[model samples]
Target chain A: MLFSLDPRISRLELPESAPAPPDKAALDQFPTYEVFHQRKENTAYVYVGPVHAPEADVAFLFGKEQFSRRFPCTGMWVVPTEAIRVTEYGDDQQSVYDRLPLLPADVLAATDAAVTEAYDIFHLKKRGKAHTHVGQVQATSPEAALQAAKAAFGDQRPVVNVWVIRSTDLLRSDEADRDMWTTTPDKKYREAIAYKVQDRIDRFKQEG
Target chain B: MYGSASTHDIPTQATTGLENEDPILLAEFEARIARGEKIEPTDWMPQLYRKQLTRMIEQHAHSEIIGSLPEGTWITRAPGFRRKMAQMAKVQDEVGHAQLLYSAAETLGKTREQMLSDLINGKSKYSNVFNYPTPTWADSNVISWLIDAGAIVNQMANAKGSYGPYCRALDRICAEEAFHLKYGHDAVVHMATGTPIQRKMMQEALNRWWPAIMTFFGPSDKMSTHTEILMRWKVKMATNDACRQQFLDMYVPKILEIGLTLPDANLRKNEDGVWEFSEPDWEDFKRVINGDGPCNAERIAVRRAAEENGAWVRRAMQQPKAQYVRPLA
Candidate 1:
């Protein structure tokens, strides 16, 4: 029974073995797709749900297509799985997490303003080391970084938990693409959010 | 799990929990509910709270999914282009409602696929309303007006129900239900003034659905049932009778105003200013939930087909595409 995955269903017990993550052997063979969603305006990007694809471009296209097909969706981001420096359960390799806060010291000398930038989302909230401030300042200067983070985040919503990378590190949509980013209207009648059942109720009642 | 933080916490305590556990913790749990603190997910609760919620949420989810069928039938048959588009949009909203419901059930640790499979396999429960057939477009109006109205009132009561996520979902859902109600009312009004044939269809739809509509509120708050534990756990804010009565009181007059006779000969408004009605065949209610209703087989089959047919889509979404090979290789 669907509901009975109910611990009561009494499954055939298998012998206990050491718990381990799935073999990474299959990882290299699979195409990777990262998911990004836009819940509201000036809201940073969020991980609503995921879908997988092979190449970077294809992954974005698939993620955008599959996840936002149902309702009112504002934006989507799709990145190749490999393009992200994600950590797996059993890897010994240094992850994007391992590289936090340490831009090579001489590299700090290389950039005049990025280091001194007053707490961008990346500097304060460790999670969003990926994207930010829509297309604005890109957290370049300390004041600019703070302003960009503040500007992108309205009402202090943890709506988008992640933001990072030099604006140069990512590929994103431009203003002209806003019309394209809208949920392609397959059929607006199927758009539930657009209809108000109560209004009709009131109108009928008044007419009666 | 122990007691709740409501007046009903003790009363709604489950038989399963009562059968187990230390007497002292059970006592203390009861005491906690008597104080009226909001129950959080991490807080201790009876296994019954989880079970009842799962039952309610899964059944509710199933209802939304199956609820799509009645509207779905009319999506193609709707008389005009506007009605066609409206029904289509309404059916799609039901799908979204199902998503929200399934997610609520998941918070209790269940999965969507598991619930869908159970619904297909005959082990889960959905509302009794969907079991009866929708024989006409007028049935569509009655459903939106009366049927959806029943659901909206019930859902509105849940806005303050105990489970946080489910309650929150109900709040959002109730806000959207206005449009659904309006859609139904619009259909009813149109049918009321429509050709003789249309009026006859609407009246017939009401007659066919009247009893099933009453039963949809579920069994009365009877002895040996578990309303006590439900109320205590805050799983149900209003009693079954309370909800059903709310439906009749609010809708009976509306039904009459539309120039239709309710099939219930015994149904009438008492001088005390309450509508009195004949009791529904509880046996029929039992038979349906036990999987014996009119369309039980068909509903299950349709769900099974969706689960089976959508397999490739689920797989494709979960899997990566084939990797490209070097030309030399």
Candidate 2:
């Protein structure tokens, strides 16, 4: 049996020796969801990172817990990785919109305002920086979304890349549930500032 | 809090295979890195860079998971409700760090499943200090304060590394680590200054852990083409010796201030401001890292059991159409 100082492990009665388990199947950890968070009210929803989850709801929960548990966050959004259309990365200090291929004349002409859906546009201001929500644009498709984003945000310099995701696909936190973001007063122990060891050390030194 | 400066079992003899890459693309890639631009997932990179980074980040991720085991065991038996809660929070953060790192590695083309498999099968390595048991609350405290202090030294350097995803993950991980370092310091100080028995236990634990902590950064790196290329790419960040020196420089005074003494007698700062200490047993470090450590079997068994037990839930929750895509930073 695997012995441990913690009786909890000893209780498990794990075998001392066992054959290595088989490798997990692909997607065993599930698909990825790109996460974005608002650090405070009236701030852009910036990309934090990605989380692996079974679905959008779980993704949102994981995103919130992973991205905002230690930091203050007022809002969160999680979208499936496959849903976000990404542009080629551009050089730092140069706008990626400059390299965007022109939308075909027929596609541009065929743009019907009534049929267009709302798409969220995100911009990478520089390489190694997180993408931030620039604005929303009405577009017929992901391709057109880039063009629409260009017309709206292309003038912004140092756009290293862009991500276009359908606004409907984003599983956003409900504004009514803002209480979830407020950390409890009892959890101060988890903050670095909560510990005061220097005082104790000083006392020991003084007494010695 | 466990991003080790050293990648255990680095294949120093392997050829870099740079000849196969297109000259123009290689030049551009090198130039981009030289210009201090971060390499994205879609960017063309040398085969060696991809392989080395995948291994390093994956190993760092495994360290976070395995490193938490020893500390997590202490949560149930922590001295008080506050300490227990803090311990629990720290363990949760470590596991969360593993999730973030796994996603970062996944962007390099490896699946999280494969990484976990490698960890259980002993194909990869975590920080070797965790392979030793934390026998007492004081032992666990040593880990919280000193082991984490060592890790912070390593991780702070790696946060400035070139990989976009790994750097991003480290930035977040480092932010959470501030609490861990302070909490650990607080825990150790509480024990060191508390009572006669408390001080003795803290001292004993420090004596037991000092060797493993010395080896935590791994052996001094031999300069070779392999190491040279990684440094130029900003992948290795700092040498193992440099990280160890920095750790000692920053933390040794703090440790001594609280009345705790490291077991090493030769450990001292020279007039040149360099630390000189007894050489850690690299042979023992190698042996333990290769699965002969005191707690290696137990750690792997526990991890493997958790994976097996949770398999059913994962299977149930998994969607047939779920497609994995590289994470966008």
Best by lDDT: 2
TM-score of chain B of each: 0.87, 0.98
Model 1 residue B137 distance off true place after TM-score fit, in angstroms: 0.9
Model 1 residue A156 CA deviation in Å: 9.4
Which lDDT tens digits does candidate 2 get at residues A1-208?
8888789999999999898888888888888999999998999999999998999999998998899888889999999999999999988889888888898888897886449999999999877779999999998999999998999988888899999999999999998999999875558999999998889998999998
TM-scores of the models, in the order given:
0.65, 0.98
Best model number under DockQ: 2
The per-model lDDT (C-alpha) reads: 0.58, 0.90
Q: Which stretches of candidate 2 lie over 4 Å from their true place?
A: none
Tens digit per residue, CA lDDT, model 2, B8-109: 767788888988889999999889989999998888889888999999999999999999999999988898999999999999999999999998999999
Assess the local accuracy of residue B279 in candidate 2 as a C-alpha lDDT between 0 and 100: 97
Model 2 chain A lDDT-worst window of ten: A105-114
Give the lowest summed-lDDT range of ten residues in model 1 chain A. Answer: A85-94
